[model samples]
Target: MEFYTKPGDYDPINYVPHQASHGTKELWKTFWLLLGITILDFIIYFVMPASGLRNVIFIFFGIVKAYYIVGAFMHLKHEKINLALIILVPTVFIVGLVMGLLYEGNAISLMK
Candidate 1:
């Protein structure tokens, strides 16, 4: 069929939208925060004896880092609440499922 109406109509193939460049301040902040969390994770991993508590601490740190990464890098922080919830709610359930599986698996091993 016919796509363009007139001589100078908008061309779909050669459309170039102008995107404003957001500065690097927020990116630098996110970088530093992620780096700090990584350093903390390493320190805790080395200093703490292997135990359930240590595992929980690592999980908590992981969630925190994931949140920051999604918020800053993925631009979820600027999105609507409903959109954010749509992505986060399933993640919460999955993490719960994993924790439950770990607990049950450990219990089963103890019985063997």
Candidate 2:
């Protein structure tokens, strides 16, 4: 029935929000970490040899970025393991499906 208690009833150990200080710090840390990874990816994109290997590297970086973005920004890191796996398992399959499509499309184009 009641949300906020009286001044004397305020208990630090009993109440904590999702966006606590630790969570905020983690969010910023994730932001900077992702920024660094993106910069590194760009450098690799320009410096690496133009080949299938480079494309695979790009896909690997993409998967890593997606994992961090989903876990941190989407707050899946705090979720239960089974719940997180529910989303992640389908995601792995989707990524595989995309890679297969790309390979098939490239083969078709080469045939043409």
The TM-score leader among the candidates is 1
Identify the leading candidate in terms of lDDT.
Answer: 1
RMSD, model 2, all Cα superposed? Answer: 6.9
The C-alpha local distance difference test score for the whole of candidate 2 amounts to: 0.82
**How far out, in Å, is residue 25 in model 1?**
0.8
lDDT of 2 at 53: 92
lDDT of 2 at 77: 92
> How well is each residue in 51-79 modelled by candidate 2, as lDDT tens digits?
98988888788878888899888989988
The runs of at least 3 residues in candidate 1 whose Cα sits more than 4 Å from the true structure, single-residue gaps closed, are 1-21
Report, for every candidate in turn, its global Cα lDDT versus the true structure. Answer: 0.87, 0.82
TM-score result, candidate 1: 0.72
Could you tell me the TM-score of candidate 2? 0.69
Off by over 4 Å in 2: 1-21
